[model samples]
Target: MSAHGETPHGAQGGHGNLNQLMAGFALAALLTIVPFALVMGEVEINRTALIATIMGLGGLQILVHLIWFLHVNRSAEEGWTLAATIFAVLILVIVLAGSLWVMKNMNENMMPMHDMEHHMQMEQMKSLQSQQG
Candidate 1:
């Protein structure tokens, strides 16, 4: 009913108009470019600080993608989409941590090749002495 001959969107989630989409795109681009610039530039930033900054910016970019591009909102579907996303993240973390743990344990417990060879030789000597006796 407005000048554009289309109804205005409400609080409910829907596709964003051109202006809103442009704003979201700008914000997303800014978020991405800042961290990339920081990494690529020769500025003397502490390693820990740089990592934290990159992670924070990455998280913000994810939010921007979810809210703007994906049109995820809390109003329409009673937060089900948000809950599903959280669950998926949780499962992924658990799987990654478990895989890391298993890898670490295996690396720690595996014997050296030389040691295994010595063990096999000792077992064969013991068996031969028993057979001769």
Candidate 2:
């Protein structure tokens, strides 16, 4: 028998660990409400700053789930787990930032003043020709 009145290799330790992990998951879930509520509220926030904050908070929440629910930090595969996390985060940043860059450029370049003026002139010429005909 071990110190807690169960065999050393008994399931008690595993159960306790599971319970603690469950508690951590519960806390994480509760914490998720904060971000959601903040988003749903109609308060004005800076667009870029708000996006960054939400992304950072989501990344933190993912880390919490990995550490607590998946036991990634304490597992024998900890190194691989950390590497995967880093890779995932890098990919996420690249995707989000790259998409934003592309979208911003598209918005800027989609309608040049020269093209607008040319279209307006064509419409005016067409109207003049129709009136003369």
Q: What overall lDDT goes with each candidate model?
A: 0.80, 0.75
Cα lDDT tens digits, model 2, 1-133, are 7787776745532334757878887878866876787689844889777777777777778777766766565345468877787788789889988998999899888978889999999999999999999
- Indicate the residue-level lDDT of 58 in model 2: 78
lDDT of 1 by residue, 1-133 (tens): 4576555654344487798899889999999999989988956989768867876787788778888888876765548988886777677658766876798799789998999999999999999999999
- As a TM-score, model 2 comes out at 0.62
Model 2 whole-model lDDT (C-alpha atoms)? 0.75
Model 2 clash number: 0
| Candidate maximizing TM-score | 2
Tell me the TM-score of each prediction against the true structure: 0.59, 0.62
State candidate 1's TM-score.
Answer: 0.59
lDDT of 1: 0.80
